[model samples]
Target: MENIRIFVQKHKKVSWLVLIGYLIFCGCFVFPLSNERWSFDFEKAYMIILSYGILATLFTSLLSSNKSIHVYSISLLCTTVGMILRYIIEYGEYSNTINFTQINIIMYLGIIPVFCTLIYWIICKLESITCK
Candidate 1:
């Protein structure tokens, strides 16, 4: 808890950038999805955005040093929060009731750390290859 607080304090600017970037990225997709004339499939767009976010976070996590796990975690948090906010803004107008079920919330929030772990594995592979 204290560590997380300190980490946020130390990397405020980077964290903010990640949050805003995620929001904008998600918004781009949301706008098209919201259009009734576009014939856009909601599930497809959602999965695309989810994969894109995972890839984006993976790359960002790769850029962090081994000691910077907190940085990676913070970035992941920002990405998840931005995504939720985008969903809220885009869908809130249509639905009077929004039920945030535990499973739905977990699935939404869990993608970050999953990709972060993948990033760590990738980084390890790279380091091993380069060190040889």
Candidate 2:
């Protein structure tokens, strides 16, 4: 916990760049167009990204404490922006309207700290590995 905070604070600029870049570059993956209908399944897309993000967060965090926060934030922000952009792009192609709600905004904002904490804990585990 303390180490992650110290790391983040020490590398504030890099952290900010990492977050911004993650948010922007998430959608760079190529997707197959054969199952066009699957593109509309925003729910499935969100679940897939979140699931993978969590797993990645776990692995990366476990590998290096100083690296966990960066990895977690990158994964979370990337998946989030990727999913939202995918939804917007798909819906826009068909001229469909996507609804936004206050609850959604609140939910996203609420999860930020929770995810950060999860990442922090994973990073904290590094103490055990490095202390020896």
Candidate 3:
């Protein structure tokens, strides 16, 4: 508990970014989007996304620590792999006809990591600004 609090305090910006990014991602589910429904392999895709999200959150929490960058890198890698897997699955199953739709959905999932990367970039920029 103490360590977690210290981590949070030390990496306040990153922590807030993670929280906000997660909220935004979750909020996207509420709207009645056309491709919101699950398809044949919905369970697998959902599981992958859930796992990726958890890993990303954990990575963000531990990012400020000097122990290892493995966790953060793995989290990002998992997200990329999951997105690719989603695209491949959709493409293989549906071919060109469904490719566009699958691409859009996969793009939505891709945004998760992009936001995380952006958050890190923003934090770095802020740090540079503070130092200057």
* TM-score leader: 1
In angstroms, the error of model 1 at 116 is: 3.4
- C-alpha RMSD (angstroms) for model 3: 9.9
Q: How many backbone clashes are present in model 3? A: 0
lDDT of each: 0.51, 0.49, 0.49
lDDT of 2 by residue, 1-132 (tens): 456546666776775566555444443232221132344366656653574444444434334555655655665666567546756666655522222334433444345434554645644665567868
Better of 1 and 3 by TM-score: 1
Off by over 4 Å in 1: 1-20, 23-64, 87-99
Q: Using lDDT as the measure, what is the rank order of every candidate, best first? A: 1, 2, 3
Name every residue pair that clashes in candidate 3: none
- lDDT against true structure, model 2: 0.49
Give the 10-residue window scoring lowest on summed lDDT in candidate 3. Answer: 27-36
User: How far off is residue 79 in model 1, in Å?
Assistant: 2.4
Q: Considering lDDT, which of the candidate structures 1 and 3 is the better prediction for this target?
A: 1
Model 3 segments more than 4 A misplaced? 1-5, 9-61, 64-75, 78-101
Candidate 2 residue 55 Cα shift, in angstroms, is: 2.0
* Window of ten residues with lowest summed lDDT in model 2: 27-36
**Candidate 2 at 66: error in angstroms?**
2.3
Residue 94, candidate 2: how far off, in angstroms? 11
Candidate 2: pairs in clash: none
